[model samples]
Target: MATRAELTEIFGAEGVISLPRSEATAAGLSEDDARVLCDVGFPAELPVIFSLDVPGDPSAFSLVPVDTGADITKVLCLGGPSGNSEMRYCLDMEDGYVILLTLGRQPAAEIINSTVDAFVEFLYRYGLRLKHIASADDRQADEYTKQLRQYLAERDPQAFAEEDTWWNMIFDRLLGKEF
Candidate 1:
């Protein structure tokens, strides 16, 4: 997992946006703000990829590289702010659709619903299609999951305190338990 600092360095600090809880909650549009801010934060005219986890409601996130044309305006951080109440990290991507790595101590159903909402909102605003590519065919999911787990394991020293320690601690973290 790449820290916000690392992501900022890779994609340029200006390209990375840290969504804090206060700002998100005060707006009563944490979800919407998260996505839009994330999109706006990503540096324009550059191909970039970033990863981070939200240690709150969702356990992990995966950002897949998308064909956002040659002109990707910005990458969106669609997930809610982390519960740490401190420095929070978001993401950066190529375009079209980016993967998210969210990790939190919440019910599986809630997380899935929230993710679906985020993805739907993004599509609705951008007029994009919701495509489902199989993970078996794409190794990106596996690689992302592994990296996410390693990241959380370091932050969350409880030894996978999310849900299914093993599953959440691995690639399945991105697929969500209900999936």
Candidate 2:
């Protein structure tokens, strides 16, 4: 298990950006749209925009699946108008893949957030850990960890309350290195 700081280092600063609603809409999606059309549920979508500039007109739905060798699953969703444009939102994990919804003017925020929630639920159902991400700065990492803890608490109060061991485990696996 890696600490939050370690995870942050591996993921890089780009990994911690808040998901942008404007980008989601620009990718033929609406504002505040969220749902899951693929493999599994995911964590809450934090606003993060990834720059994927290239040449020519490359417009298509791309799903990237990376195996992080963790108990949890992960996925990233990327789409845009041109080849040089960046991804509206990306979900990264080791568990499953993001769904490509080919529709007109979908809500990026809703879609991204809902899909992530679904995946997070999926991980909990399987008693698995969710993908861990962190910020490079210590203060940022601490804030992110606190937010994650709050999210976990709100999502699974009982599970969170009953386990001192799980907290230690999660802390170790998600934000351990910094401590």
RMSD of 2: 14.5
N/CA/C clash count, model 1 = 20
Per-residue alpha-carbon lDDT of candidate 2 for residues 1-179, written as tens digits (9 for 90 to 100) = 22223323434444322334444444433222222322221222222212233232222233333333553332345433133242333444322222322233542221222334433342332222223332246666665666766765565454354434334344444565532
lDDT (10s digit) by residue, model 1, range 1-179: 23334335444655454445554444343454454444333222121111234344322232223233565333333444334322222234322232333333431111211232233322222111111223234466545445545654454334344564432522353445452
Candidate 1 regions exceeding 4 Å error are: 1-5, 17-137, 162-173
Q: Which runs in model 2 stand beyond 4 Å of their true positions?
A: 1-135, 172-179
How do all models score by TM-score?
Answer: 0.26, 0.27
- Per-candidate RMSD, Å: 16.3, 14.5
Cα lDDT, all candidates: 0.35, 0.36
- Candidate 1 TM-score, C-alpha based: 0.26
